[model samples]
Target: MNVLCSESMKIEEEVSDDSGTAAVHSLPTELLVLIFSWLSVEDLALNVSKVCQRWKDSLYFRTLWCDKELIYENSREDLFIFVLSVAPALKQLSLNPLFCGDPAAIVNAICKGPKDIRKVHYNLSLFPAAVASRILGHYKKYVCELHLEGYANKHSSIYRNLDAELGQMSQLRSLKLSGYFDTKWDKKVLERGCLNLHHLDVSLIQDESDSYKPFLDNVKSHLKTLKLPQFKSNVGVLELVSSCTELKEITLCLDDLRCISTLQSLESLHIRWSDGVLKSKMNRFVRDCPVFGNLKELTLFYIPGLLATAIAKQCNKLETLNLHGITSCANIIKSVPSLQKLCIVDRLSLRMRHIQKLPRYIPNLRHLNVLGSFLNKGIPPKIISQLKQELPELVISSEPFVRYTKRGNKGYFTKCTDSSTDCSSDEA
Candidate 1:
């Protein structure tokens, strides 16, 4: 703490008025802009803008709009107008329902605003179907990635609208269709929307009907990644997956290897037990998928032991691995020379023995993310420091979850929820 304070003091002194010169104001505008980019929107609006005309000019609100990262909690009413005016520059927009004021206005703005916005994250459980439909309709031609929450339920009116808009999503690439307990995936819309999709996630529905036939039929040749919904069985999508000639990535909660065994083209695989799936025969699953010689990335959630060892032995071309709930490193696994990134976050049994074996197995392992641990004291700093010494190129980090403040600055660090971590597994 004292060291941090001393560093802060030193930084302040370097930019202080010690030389009787207005050094800060005299700096180049380009350098000032680079420094100001680190500040939050609130800082730019309330503090930095008040410094001088030159400073205010350097803060481009339009450039801020390009981020499309919204923070509306306790925000003013005019935020909608501001966002709407600058929606053209944004690539992604996040909406939180707790304080999602002026949804109609913001949606209207984005609908008519830009063709560049490719991603939208709406977290309102009861977001209006009309607004969602309108925005999606407007951005249908260009939007590629879509993540929507709390709308696909039996009771929500947005499902119908979303279903109707499915056909128009011509360029849509990735879809994360998370829903409530009563949500049902309309087979026709699902099939139509998936025609050109490379990545599809529908893991929040109440029931996944065998209607996956048509959906898989349309994208069987084009689909690269598929995430099955909760409570759904592999039997429902097994035959469908069998037909996908170009399938490369698959995330399934059920421990079903037969469904993935035939996909020789698979590059990334994620397996786990779903809430509705019974005892997972992980050993059989791994044994069945020995044909995955082309696999590059593998993720196992709540996985049993022995499976990782099997993967290490078979998928020698593997580059990234994420293992959660793994008790031990299992039997002596062969070295996967191509492995790059490894993440084992929020596990109870991961120890030095498990970590120490990485360098022996994955020679090229570079970025190791052991972030968001709530159950136990995460990987010790001393251990990480020592590992760095042993493998100088290996980058190890233990990060706590951090969110944005109301003022748009980085908020405090805290333990993230399980659902949040699960959602971020792919991106991480």
Candidate 2:
């Protein structure tokens, strides 16, 4: 009887140990919440909500929400509920007015819940001017960043109301406005009210006759970054650049290269131009622009010879150079001794003749991207083989064709086993 009791006790202990092991394998609810917090709210609502009821409950936590909110058709209800639940914690909000019928209701809901809201972005294409004005006036105290886009026709009252309401935001730091504005009205609001603005992106709807000098001059001293598609004249560009002594980066879609010469403090430049006449001007602009000497990165689309030469000579410290359909890259590479990464997209044609001319001066070369179907055909196997021998430390990657070799004491090609064989792996 004593031996039977001992055996039964041992069996009970074994069962208890197995149950403990199973409990240890299961993830705790707190750990799951921490993991879900890293995901965007949209992703959580869409994917995690279907996993289980516990996941759905975890999604309601406000800390998981991102600073920027983009709403689409499927997730409209989720966002609406989220806003109502945590309106006070919200700082930045972007709403598609086309999908949202009641802009005033949304604004009121936000104001009632959270008086701390600081930024608001909305598409004003459909909202009446009066409604927009009412919404803007309500949040004027806390709102710092505002983005609005709409047609600037006479019927749209939003433009005038916007100009008026914008003048009242003393804490406003960033403003992005897209549409036409009355010359006198715009000048008055910018000069008198937007004194604290540090970042500005405006698409001028008015003609060149409308002098924007006052607005530009008002914000120039505080402006750190400026992006504009087109500038009317050389004077406007010069005034804009000269005023912004703290300007670190500038992007322009215009063809005129002449503007580059005026921006002395520019550390980064991006441009896209099509016409050959404009391309020639760009070349000249790059050569003359002293700003290129301080530039760390440059992105160009269809830039011509003089500019390419100028970039190589002036941008000695350039770390990244991105060129699209560039015909004169051979000249640029010769000058940029500090270049570490080069991205080239040859849409016109891919011929080894141009690539072979690349200077051997790039000792710090780490990454090279070549686009165009012909790049592979243009480069001979011998040249590729020789490059592999010379640049043993270099990492050569072309989507669907990646070859990596290590730089040993004595240079030699060694196949990299870590490379993926799938063709689609190089999409990035």
Best by TM-score: 1
> In order, what lDDT does every prediction score?
0.62, 0.61
> Lowest lDDT 10-mer window, candidate 1?
419-428
What 10-residue stretch in candidate 2 is worst by lDDT? 419-428
Best by lDDT: 1
Model 2 clash pairs? 88-114, 283-307
Model 1 gets an lDDT of 0.62
Residue-by-residue lDDT tens digits, candidate 2, 1-428: 34334433322122246455433214444455557666665666567777777666655555455363534233365556454454334566665555455555565665465544577776665556676776677777887787766554545455654556777787778877666544444666666674577777764443443334566677788777766645444456565665577777776654544565656777877766644355555556656667778888888876665655665687867988887876767677777779878777775544556555443767677666674534432333444555545555555445444345767888877744323332212222
Overall local distance difference test of candidate 2: 0.61
Residue clash pairs of candidate 1? 66-89, 203-229
If scored against the real structure, what TM-score would every candidate get?
Answer: 0.71, 0.70
